[model samples]
Target: QGVVDPLGGINTLWPLFGIGNQMLASMALILGTVVLFKMKKQRYAWVTILPTVWLFITSMTAGWQKIFHEKPSIGFLAQANKFRKGLDEGVIIAPAKSVADMQTIVFSNQINAALCAFFMLVAVTMLISAFFVIRRALRSDLPTTHESVVTLRNKEVRHV
Candidate 1:
């Protein structure tokens, strides 16, 4: 059996992983903003709204770069194209042990690029859904989902 390299292709994987993680954080912040709106506290919603917007923008930008940038190190598609060119010329490029390794690298990069695109799509969908929910909450007098606060009377308290 051949031993697998634990760190192989990590350069391509790291950006995709980072984007996925940030997308999740962005989703949570969007949910927080929506909850604040539902509670009729639109003013305080900016606390979460700012982070949500920042995360969304940054994550999307990163994902876009990973998918489309020209540099092989920065873009998965670019890396894939580079390897494919090498494969077409029947040359084994650096970091690729053989023609088969070059083929695997090309396919791996393509998969990574697709994954990055998928993450971006999910993030956009979530942001759009949150926008509608927040708009509805602001325009309508929706009942709050939180429990009412109850104050205890001094007479109801027993001395230990």
Candidate 2:
């Protein structure tokens, strides 16, 4: 018999997980450049390409949080100060800063949340598209279609 599947779950999830996240990003860069060179249907390519840029920016901000131990932005000082106050009543005085800094931290958090939501939407869409493509491929039978009497395309032939 044929070889048993070595990666059952991965084979199923690869397109949705792999392509929708990492592979799509790489493809976006390559395909975007190719589309620009070909001068073809660029609108579709831009839709895929723009998200990679957003992902890059978001990853930069989020990655810093994961990689380093740093104080919150000045905008978040109020919340940070609030926590510090609770920790030691006599210590950890809040830094003097403009209200704008607090607003900036709050705004950054909001921006971060919004970016995550948008990327999730993109991933879902990519998953659906992948499913449809796989479904079509599974349903298609070129071997049988060639034997059929009906023509798939009806364009008139032009002989040079």
TM-score of each: 0.85, 0.35
Alpha-carbon lDDT of model 1:
0.81
Candidate 2, which segments miss by more than 4 Å at Cα? 1-23, 26-96, 143-160
lDDT of 2 by residue, 47-140 (tens): 6557755764454344333223245432123334444444445332233243443333334334433444455556446545644643454454
Q: In order, what is each prediction's RMSD in angstroms?
A: 5.5, 17.4
Model 2 Cα displacement at 141 (Å)? 0.8
Candidate 1's C-alpha runs over 4 A off are 1-9, 147-160
lDDT of 1 by residue, 84-127 (tens): 99989888888888877787788788888888898888889988
Worst 10 residues of 1 by lDDT: 1-10
The prediction achieving the highest lDDT against the true structure is 1
